[model samples]
Structure formats: C-alpha cells, structure tokens
Target: MTPDAGSALAGLTGADSVAHWTQRYGHALMDTFGAPQRVLVRGEGPYVWDADGTRYLDLLGGIAVNSLGHAHPTLTAAISAQLGTLGHISNFFASPTQIALAERLLDLAGAPEGSRVFLTNSGTEANEAAFKMARRNTGLDESGNGVRRTRVLALEGGFHGRSMGALALTSKAAYREPFEPLPGGVEFLPFGDADALRAAFADGGGATVAAVVLEPIQGEAGVRPLPPGYLALARELTAAHGALLVLDEVQTGMGRTGTWLAHQHPHLGGGIVPDVVTLAKGLGGGFPVGAVVAYGERAATLLGRGQHGTTFGGNPVASAAALATIGVIDRDGLLAHVTDLGAWWRQQVAALGHPLVAEVRGEGLLIAVELTAPVAADVAARALAAGFVVNPCTPTTLRMAPPYVLTREQAATFTDFLAALPHDLGEATP
Candidate 1:
C-alpha cells in the first residue's frame, strides 16, 4: 500500500482504536474544543455506543441540540425522503418545505400578522441576522453618515454565540478579549437585576440604544432562569426607550423547557412577545437549522432586498427534518412528558440527600445541579466512568439536558447513579 493509504488503515481496526484515532485527531484538528472524552460510534434514543461498544446514557443531548435524541425514526425518515426528492436550492429560489417551515415557525412563535422569518445554519448565524436587523432598525442605512442609534445591550454571564457579532453580545471576558475590538457599543448588565436594567435604560440618553438582547434562561451560565417579572420588566423598559428586545432562545427553545419558547411559560411572563427572537439548537432535532423571527412591521422590514442571504439556510431536507421534529413533539405529547420528567428528576436528585449536591434549578429537561463544593468536573468524569454522560458547565454546576423521549426508567437509573457518585469515586457516601 502507499504510505498515506497504509497510515489510514493503521487506525481503522484495533483493540485501541479510540486511542489511535484520538492521537490522529490531536494532530489533524484544531485544538479548539480541547480533548474529546470518547469516540462515539452510534446512538439510539438517549444512548450512545463508544468505539469499544460500551454504551452510555447521553444526558447532555449534544449540548441541548438533540431534541428528539439519536436516530429518531421520524426525523431520519423525513430527512431521507426530502433528500431523495429534492436535496437543496439556492436563496434565489424557495422550496415547498422551506416556505412551509417558515409558516410553521411563525405559527409556533404565535407572531403577529406581519411577522417574518430569516433562516440560517446555526445559532451564531441566527444571532448575526438579528444583530444586523437591530442595526437597521435604527433607521441608519449602510452609509456611515446617518447614525441614529448604535448601542446594544446584553446580560452578564449570558452567552449568545462565538461569532464576532454574537461574541460581542456574550458577556464572558475570556470569550470576548481574544477577539478584541468586537463590533463595538455592546454593554452587559447583571442578569435578572431589575435595578441595573432600569438604570441602563434611564442613562441611555433617551434612545441612544438600538436593541437589548437577552436569554430568558441562561444556559451556559449554569441553567440560570430569569427571576420573576424580569422579562416583563425588560419588555417594559425596551418599549419605553424605543429599543428592540431580542430574545436568544438558541438553547432554551424547542420544548427543551417544556414550552415552544421559554418566554411563553406562565412563570416567565407568558403572552409577552419580543421584537425579535433567535432560535436554533433543538429546532431541527439533529439536523442543522437556525432562524430569526421578527414580530412587527418595523422589525420585519429592517433587512431589505440585498442586505442578507444564506446559501444553505432553508434547504429542503433540513426543513423537512424540522417539520418532522415538531410533528413528533406534538404527536407524542413530549411537552407534557418533558414537564413531568423535569420536575420528577429534579425532586429525585435533590432528595438524594447527597452532601455534595447543594441545589437543583431549571425548567423542563434543562437542569443544573449546583454542588456545595467545586467538584462538578470530578462528578462528570465519575458519571461517565459509570456509563452516563453529563456536562460540567462550570466548576460548580453539573448540567443535564436529556432527550424528551427519555423514559422514566432511564431517568431513575441515571438518578440512582448520581446518588452513588460519591461512593463510586471512592469518597464517603452521603
């Protein structure tokens, strides 16, 4: 065999297949996500198999992206049918599924009559579209001459995305400093701090701000939900100041929190709609699709004919996958299933009486177990060793976002493992 062909075959089959591939990965790929924990081979429902055929319950759900879990028949079938019929088309043209998905998103959003949709491939792209819309809503054309309003505001510890514009709205200094001089005029205030929000609007010089973006539930900040009336307060403040309110529902939307959108939850100020909403993550079940939905004429018309475009935004197969996902969620009653599972799981985890676990907080299947000690990384590692997959969002927060179709028995088994974490790690049992 040729040298390159021989090298490829060296890692294809072996008892140490994962090790060989991991070594190859470190050499071939960028060191962006650090070392991968395991080399996953395949998945079904909420379980995944490793290179060695070891199975794990995937509690993280691909960082909240896999709403219908792995290998969901409906999602897979929809994608296959659409790809077989019509794979993709350019933005210059539109497909039946594309228009249908847009209509379905508007219906799910419960948007007003003139609401509009802009589709993209991921959450960052969705946020970029929203940011551009916010800029345009200031009545300032692309020319630098007419600058009506330029400032954008976000919340502390809130994450929008990693792209330059979205990263500017993200509050993490480590994430922002590396990409210095980001799209400027973006400020962050303490999340859920009503006083801080009110004061910022008060000092905005009566319409110096273009938009205020926020996540109703902060996922990267350890599943932190907004305090009572906080979203309503934001709506009131932004409306009073004539600034747009952009809700980044990238992580919390798509029934992850047992609602079409977290902001629609009664506890989170139901019936209060924002000017713009960004959605991705679970929208396509495992297929990649993101969208920006604008409510009124003012917000919808911000981007004119040639302002923005996407090559693979509303591909027929991806749109079909999303439609199938939404249909399954509604047909299988996953909304109520996730609601009951979330409450029950939280109660069981908290009642485990483990000394390390301090509190459990979240909505629906999106949850975080705050540790009394900063042993979250340790716990996650231990859980993986015990055949479960979880995420350590922070040093003290263990985040869990399992599939909507996860059964009660699967949840019970995971909870039982969590209760035995300390003992499994060779520490004294609680």
Candidate 2:
C-alpha cells in the first residue's frame, strides 16, 4: 500500500482500520505467531504507532532485538552505506565490514588468543553452529583412548532455538514432543540444582558428555538468573571432565544485561570463561545477525574448512549494521544507563506495594515482574489498552526489555500506570 493510502486507512474508525489490516495479515501470513498484536506502522526510539494511529511505549523492544531502538539513524546509515558499496558476496570472498565485525566481536567478548567467530543470520543458526562444534570436538582423551562424547547436557526450562539441531538442545517438552525422535543424546538437568548437575557428571566422570549448554540468565523461563556458583561449578566440571561449556547468550548479550555478555557480569558470571558462546538478538540492533564465539585454540578449531558454511552470513550489509550498533552503544554509553535505570526501575516498582507483584527480577533492562497469580495475560492486555506494550512471558510473569534510550520520565509513566492499577484486576468472575 502507498504511504498516503496507509494514512487514509488509519483515518477510519480504529477498530475497522485494525480489523482490515489484521484480516489481510491472517490470510497472507503463516499462523506461526497466532495473530498480529497490532498493525505497527512505524516506530521511533522506544515508541511505535499502530495502524490506528495510536502510539504505545514499546516495553518489549521487539522481543529484546532492538538494542538501539527503532529507526536508529546510525544503524540505518551504516546499512545504507554498506549496501551502496557492497552487499552480498560468496563465502569464497570476504568484505572489509565482515572482517571488522568478526574482529570486533572477538574483542568485545574478550576471547583469548586463537579464538574465532562464525557469523550467521540469526540466533538459531549460531546455536546450530555451536552444536556442530560440540560434536566435532569429541576427540581422543589422554592415554590415546578414543572417547565418544555424544551426550550434551542442557538445563530444564532452557530455550536454544526452533531449528532441528538447536531445538534438540532445547528442553521444553511441548516444543520437542511434537517433533519426536529428534537428534538424540541431549539430556536435561533440573535447573539450578547443583546436586542434579553433580550427579550427571558423577557417572563416567562426564566422559560421554560433549558439552554443557546453558543460558547465563534463562530469558524464556521468566528471566531467571542462574543461582550463585552454578555457572562456576559448570565451568569446573566441564574443564575437569574434558567437556565444552557452551553458553547461549542469544537473549542476554550485546549490552542487554549491562555487560557485553551476561556471563561476563561479576555477580552473575563470577569471572568464569566459557569454551563457546552464541550471540544474536541485539547484536545488529534491529537487523538480523548472529555469531558463535569459540574461545581458546581447541574450541576455535572445532569446525574447520568445509565443516560449516553460510551464504548470506557475514555479508557486508549485516556486518555494517552490527558494527554501527556496537559503535552507537559505546558512544552513547548505553551500558551504564541500562545498569542504573534497571536497578532504579525495579526499586520503584517494588516500592509501589502492589499486591499482584510477587517479585521483580533480572539484570539491566531485561526485567520481569512475577505476579502472585497467573494473570500475566490479563495484565499484558490491560497494558496494551493503556498505550503500553509488554509480554506475558509466562502465566505469572510480565517481561519488559525497553530500549536503552528510554528516559527516567518515560519509565516513570509506566510506574504510574502500575500504581493506578485496579486491585481486583485479576480477580476471577463467578
């Protein structure tokens, strides 16, 4: 539709206008996402306008993918300039932007000497690459004995991705059972249970384990951070047992958690180093890009020539977008802002004394409000009606990952909404 036509469509009654577009969406698009929340016409900074011309404070930040926020000038300019110069090139060839981005990621991740990066178009692809690295690293142990390390340990309530290989590593039964007989050898340990983790490694000294995949903060599982010392123990066990520690930072990397990587946070990560780390989501701001950062010589060389490849990955345009995003995050000092604002915001919400609020958890801007009851869906619906956008991440959790550009005043507006919420909002009707 033309810009003028879209504007005219919005002039209609809000319901009619939204219905028209949503009807078209249902007919044209796949049902994977169920229904369009709203026909978002455009966005700027942390706000978006729907087809009805109504505006909303985008608290979800495109599901934590919009690091620099919507319509960021720097990201746009970088992508445009790179596309004007060079866009896509075969894997046999490389561009300066691609090389620079890879180097930048390695540097930001503090990867040791001999570490390497494998770029991809999304988080799922990054995880898929890490899965391959884990499999390929199953070589002979000491004493020249071949050890078939086929088993990969993952945590319960973890989410890797939807692709075949990545999905195999994911633990949710609903996401796995439908596609039965998935790639085998993935075992799920009870989340945050040190005993369960220790017991798993007790047998065979983890000789059959190829890798232990974990999310420093489990985003999909209601923004739960790993308990203290859990990560350090994993690192020690994996190191002593000759297994790789693969961390999936797809939802927590690139300054989302006030640190470039969540596992780098002193309190959260305890200064432990992982063998492999997968990143995406905010890496390219709103643009699509992902990477597998393999640390040390052993993990870096896991996937050698001809073992893994992607045509559109590491293209000049995507690389430029990511570089520009990183540059803006550094130049604008968003990391410190997220850290400071997130702490204050949580305190503000907690002090409201809202009976519905059970807990406020998460680091940096990735926050979740755990409710005393299973009314997150209702609360999110009310939030939408009140010119805000939030996610019902679970039956009892409301998640918010607003842009780093969000100001204190804007955040206060949301707190005011919470203060004015009806006490009986979630009460069931007889």
Maximum-lDDT candidate: 2
Please list the residue runs of candidate 1 whose C-alpha ends up more than 4 Å from where it truly belongs after superposition. 1-16, 139-147, 423-430
lDDT of 1 by residue, 180-217 (tens): 99998888888889998888877545377889899988
Residue-level lDDT of model 2, residues 157-178, one tens digit each, is 9999999899999999899989
Candidate 2: give the clashing pairs: none
Separately for all candidates shown, the number of backbone clashes (residues 3 or more apart, or on different chains) is 0, 0
Worst 10 residues of 2 by lDDT: 7-16
TM-score of each: 0.94, 0.95
lDDT value, residue 187 of candidate 1: 86
Evaluate model 2: give its TM-score: 0.95
